[model samples]
Target chain A: MTTSIHTLDTPVAVVDVARMNRNIQRMQQRADSLGVRLRPHVKTTKCAQVVEAQIQAGAQGVTVSTLKEAQAFFTQGVTDILYAVAMAPNKLAHALDLRRAGCALIIVTDSVAGARAIVEFGRAHDERFEVFIEIDSDHHRSGVRSDDPLLGDIAKMIHEGGAVLKGVMTHAGESYKLNTLEALQEIAELERSECVKAAEAIRAAGIPCPEVSVGSTPTALSAVHLEGVTELRAGVYVFFDLVMHNVGVCALDDLALSVLTTVIGHQPDKGWIITDSGWMAMSRDRGTQAQQCDFGYGLVCDSNGTLIDGLLLRSANQEHGVASFEEGMSVDVEKLYPIGTQLRVLPNHACATGAQYPAYEALQPNGEMAHWSRVNGW
Target chain B: MTTSIHTLDTPVAVVDVARMNRNIQRMQQRADSLGVRLRPHVKTTKCAQVVEAQIQAGAQGVTVSTLKEAQAFFTQGVTDILYAVAMAPNKLAHALDLRRAGCALIIVTDSVAGARAIVEFGRAHDERFEVFIEIDSDHHRSGVRSDDPLLGDIAKMIHEGGAVLKGVMTHAGESYKLNTLEALQEIAELERSECVKAAEAIRAAGIPCPEVSVGSTPTALSAVHLEGVTELRAGVYVFFDLVMHNVGVCALDDLALSVLTTVIGHQPDKGWIITDSGWMAMSRDRGTQAQQCDFGYGLVCDSNGTLIDGLLLRSANQEHGVASFEEGMSVDVEKLYPIGTQLRVLPNHACATGAQYPAYEALQPNGEMAHWSRVNGW
Candidate 1:
């Protein structure tokens, strides 16, 4: 049931559906066993077809990074969505629209100004929107300090404004920067504790808090205990990338998505094999900058999905990818992959690479191909 | 004439139409003065509107990174399109589709297999496709060596395959690696010499060679002489990015496209300003990896398009951008930019960043906004 190249176009993003289902089931099982709800983040695929698979795998709700995603998924019949980013006033109308459309919309905010903006917007619209106060767990990225006076003030303001203060949410985003799984687990525990503390502060301030959310692919996958986290929101787990593998979050084999390309030329003298898939196809996501190993842009795979022994897309231009084999690794670039030979490249960041193309050519376990379009932009 | 936020969404890509028009005119003037055909590469924007603008500014033909781009522009009445990439068999049909639809299509190949594949596809389909033998210049990314023995053999084969061997093409992509304009000029000269030599070899082998092409934004913009280049193909000049500025191809003021985002929150004590524009909005293109100065992700701008002093997006998550103001350069984040305040962010690589979104919100010089969609995928 393998689709012929003639029917499909080159440099189109293709996802192995069988592999993706397996990946989703595995993550769902892990969350179920841990007594935690898995809220699969839709930011990775931005495809309704993929989100349907996640929902089928027992995902409690979905997390989105943009209002456009919430609007798209809400239209597609998936109502519960957590807009994982801080809600801005300009985007309030879109959020309110989703809320009015029967979506259990949850928006995150960290500052007093943010809380006020949401309150003002919610008041004007006469909408009671669910709100999550973002807590700074490791001081890695954006968040309100867990014990900061601002956190209590924001929670109190949200409660007074008639909006439901769901609880606190924090992401151990810097867990990806850890060198070991132990470090990731430690970061996870810290994130959980910080979130719990933020929730407790809001409660102590006479505000009702329902859930404490904490997430990061590395931390969630490695965390020993989900002490306070009622829901986990991790996106990259569905299509593990090189950065995930480098951080000990997943193995290279766990990567379900790949960029299928064709070798178009070669510089035998320089040991470079040129491919039609360049940065435009594979994406410019060099996720190895903070990792232990740099596999150039990505791991090169044969047409059959087997990792090539030494080949690497070391450099790329707009429309040209240059493959460099390891110093003495034996791989016949000239014969093994002729000019028309098809190959797949596992990307450094699946989400970034996936977003570059418009649609995905889904491949089933039986090798059947189905075209699925991905939604983009806000 | 200013359009309200409700008219166009925040965190949307905006291209200053007036600046882009000026950029097109300037580049066309440079090419006209140099007495060379300007085949402006459409890879930067991938928008037919931008391509139409380029053509209107005197671009004789256009260069495309993918067959999909060629198809889109051709459908928009752009007849002459150079598929400025090594042509693979998988994409031959789509390239032929463009040709059959009355497009003056030209593709490039460097390997015997590439030449033979294009020839075989042409023969099987009974179609003719123009081709240029891609020559490896200073950039070792792709293409056959200028003096490879297979060069002459491949050229002869392409000429006899019912397809015209236009000549040769080379790109000094490494010109972006230069630190000074003088170095870029040297790389430009080297690129021109390589293309000329490849064409000379094909001519010496008794093949009809009519065109020699060479291009790279840095090379095309800095080259003082164009001795052998019949056509110049350069992208990224229309919307200069951080990479272009670092490479001395353009200045900071030359950047025409930017992501318009809203400041959603602030971590005042930490000097962190959070914006709705994250990697998903700004793209994960850190093109300054090779440059001495790392502007984090990109330069930050006020709502009025003025570059913020010493403030840069220091870190980014999937949907969150964290800006850090250099020590001693402090501005009240909340005061200057409240929760609803709009800001613009100049991207690292315009092409990669621009591709994340579906369309451009074209901003006129006087601040009016119009929408234009960009084509994606192959």
Candidate 2:
């Protein structure tokens, strides 16, 4: 009773169920052995089913980029969630609603104004909230520097304003810029040490800090030590994209999701084969920019899911993709993919491509199909 | 009354009504005097409100890239639609549903299997579908070359089947690759002439050839003459992006939509200001590959929607963006944007970024906000 292309709609997302389970279990086992609580980020899939899988595989908490995700998952019985993004004043009500719904909501902030806004919102709603002062570990993206004087001030404000200080959190976002695993490991250590130091600073300021969170898909997965970190929040591990593979975080086989498309035309003279999948199908995520290897939009695969070596989607439009094989790479396009023949395309960034589609067609080990819905919007 | 940030949720999308209406009228008026049918592609906005505005502005029909989009717009009273992508077997039933609901669908196909599949589906469903044989114009993406010997044969097969032949169509997708407007105009003329030749071949083979549709936002806008193109199907003109401006299609001021975000933190030493807008908010669309100028992720704007000269979002993580100004291009990060201050970011690709959020907060000329939902998923 294997489900084939005839049973599903074109342009629908499909996840290899066995591979997905493996990805979840592998990360959970690593986190468990490292003595750190695993809080797998749900922003990758935005699907309750995927989140449930992670929870069943031993994720103690879930990380979300938006308050909408927190509210949606809270309604679905996921009580512990880390709203990983800086909360805006507009989203305060939604956060309060999640807190009222018995959610162990954790919010991150680095600015004095952000701290004040959250504090004011908590007072107005008369709700006690958990807060973490974000530390900038690598000067890559957001957060106050680990040694910034403002860190202690923000911690004091959060403590005095009736909010529970939940230690500190930081992301080694620059870890993705590393070209070698050694560089990534160095970044991981730096992130852990900085977070511990930031927590120590808050403790010295008379704030009771309980948990220190650190995350980055590359750094978290490859970190050899978790001496100070109490929790790990890494998304994109469950669905490894081209960017992850290029950074040596995961292998090609570890990627659990892909966009299934069909060959629509061919230009043999120009050595171009057209597929129905375009940027809209795979997303405009050029995660290969920093990678050692550039896999155009994504790694092309044959109908049976075998990686088509040297073939890449060289160009794309809104609804059409042009694939070109590397020089001297030869394959019988007409025989392997007669017009209308179906094939799968691995994404450059799973989170972006996966978000473009509405639902996932879960393919079991034996090829049976089970549909799962994904959440979108704010 | 003006809409307050407190009334809207974080991560929700917003559209400027005045700018959008102006964009609609400008394109409509341009196409009207050109004596070509203005068939606005709905893929850019995908909002019913935006589609209604296009229709009210004298757009004769709508263009969509997927069967799901076709069904959505059809249900919304858009009776005429051109499903711009190659129609696959999986989408045939959905296309038939739209036709059964009394919607006129113009689908595109270039191969024999595609033609056969559509014909078979039409016969099985006891319905007739209108189709256009897609022709390659500049080897940009999909479609058979106009000079391909099989072009006439594919047209004959469709004409012999129960489906109605609606001439041929082509898109100069490569027009975006041009470095100058002269190149764009050349590509446009090439696309229009190629499509006309393909339609002529179909008519010579005794098929009814009524319309030769050619489109590409860059080409359509800069084209001096569209003599052979009976109908134009450009979409991105409604919301010009950095890609459009780079390709000489539209100016930066012509971009009608932007991602609204709030400043969260700053690193004074590094001159880095972080915002809530990241790849998730602006989309990971690097439209600068073909453009002469690279705007990093997108053009930065101030709280009042004014473009911040010399400042661009140099880097982004999944949930955080860091803006960098050119050397010596001084700007007040603290005075202009205190923490929690709102700002807007123009996108690199309008269609890709617009698809990230689920709805648009339609802002009236007076700054009053109204909710307009956009359809997503397959």
TM-score of each: 0.97, 0.95
Candidate 1, position A336, lDDT: 71
Tens-digit lDDT string for candidate 1 (A143-229): 888878888888988999888899889998888888687788789899888999988888887888989988878888888888767
What's model 2's lDDT at A257?
Answer: 91
Q: Which residue pairs in candidate 1 have backbone atoms (N, alpha carbon, C) closer than 3 angstroms, thus clashing?
A: none
lDDT of each: 0.84, 0.83
Question: What's the C-alpha lDDT at position A227 in model 2?
Answer: 95
User: Model 1: residues >4 Å from true position, as ranges?
Assistant: A1-7, B1-7
Quote the lDDT for B46 in model 2.
87
Scanning candidate 2 chain A in windows of ten residues, the lowest lDDT window is: A1-10
Local accuracy of candidate 2 as per-residue lDDT tens digits, B1-378: 477633655444567777788888888877887789999888998888899989999999899977778888888888889988888776777777778779998888888778888888888888778999998898766788888878977887788888888878888877877868778778888998899998887778777889999887877777788786789888988888888888876778778888888777777677777888888888888888557898888888875678878888887777788887898977777666676677778888889888888788777787678877887766
The candidate 2 chain B region of ten consecutive residues with least summed lDDT is: B4-13
Pairs of residues at least 3 apart in sequence or in different chains that clash in candidate 2: none
Give the local distance difference test score of model 1: 0.84
**Number of the top lDDT candidate:** 1
DockQ of each: 0.80, 0.66
* lDDT minimum window of 10 residues, candidate 1 chain B: B1-10
